[model samples]
Target: MVDFGTAEVTLEMVQASQIGMKALGAALAVGMTGIASAIAEQSIGSAAVGATAENRDVFGLALLLTVIPETIVIFGLVVALLILF
Candidate 1:
């Protein structure tokens, strides 16, 4: 047993801690997904640009592929919302 102070823990304190944890979870969900989306888009976008430069006819497909990674961010936002509320 360690007795160094007389700090009292209350219900409000516990509730606040839980809220903080939920916020942290939500932030991590969104942050990590955004980072992953950026990384994915970086490579896909470069490839799409190269493909588009090679042949203008491929522009539509390349654009579609490049935009696909953005859905991950939307998914992340949903997860974050779920975590937060």
Candidate 2:
């Protein structure tokens, strides 16, 4: 085992920590956005189903609305990519 108690901080250590933070940020960005989108879609999906059930004509529109929340996930993916690379 290596002891870090008396070790001096180096540039490489700082860079490594920065990279780790970036990775953590990227993961958080993707995870939070995915959860948010999922929550949004859950309510929207239920409402859309009810609307579709009442009127068959609104089925297409409901489908489109349900898909709209998915864009948040896409945006999250972009942000994660930006952070990671």
Candidate 3:
């Protein structure tokens, strides 16, 4: 029954909204990183497979290169955690 024009925003409401925004940011950080990692891995995996086929000795180097892109996801998770906490 409160009048819309007379309604006032409280500090708690502002804080709650801030928390929600932070959560959204965290989710975005993780989601984008995961997507990027997948894209990077797709290309790297194909290249690695081709290289490995050319030289069996290159398997170790190819594996290392393929795994390097995974660090993006790990960093994203860390950023998300920081945003949430």
Candidate 4:
């Protein structure tokens, strides 16, 4: 019976709607963050590995790109914490 933002649909009447929605939201939050970080780090790792495989002069750029995914992870974590807490 709870009203979520603007939706007036009743979960109590919908059986598994409430739980499903909660799980969905949690999944979306974490999944999106995880995906973004994975994609970012995947590229960075590939580039760094490729550079290492080729030569040792690309260390700085590799390190920099490797840490770039951290910002997205932090943002996702903060959002998840706010949602859970």
Report the number of the highest-lDDT candidate.
3
Q: Is candidate 3 or candidate 4 better by TM-score?
A: 3
Which residue pairs come into collision in candidate 3?
none
Candidate 3 worst ten-residue window by lDDT:
1-10
lDDT of 4 by residue, 3-69 (tens): 5687665767576775677667766787899898998899889979899778888888888888889
User: On a 0 to 100 scale, what is the lDDT of residue 72 in model 3?
Assistant: 97
Candidate 2 or 3, higher lDDT? 3
lDDT of 2 by residue, 7-79 (tens): 8999999999999999999999999999999999999999999999999999999999999999999999999
Angstrom error at residue 53, model 1: 0.5
RMSD values for the candidates in order, in angstroms, are: 1.1, 3.2, 3.1, 7.1
List the global CA lDDT of all models. 0.94, 0.95, 0.97, 0.79
**Model 3 vs. true fold: TM:** 0.85
Query: Considering TM-score, which of the candidate structures 2 and 4 is the better prediction for this target?
Result: 2
Structural similarity to truth (TM-score) of each candidate: 0.94, 0.89, 0.85, 0.61
In angstroms, give how far residue 52 of model 1 lies from its true place. 0.5
Query: What residue runs in model 2 are displaced by over 4 Å at the alpha carbon?
Result: 1-4
Question: What lDDT does candidate 2 reach at residue 24?
Answer: 95
Clashing pairs in 2: none
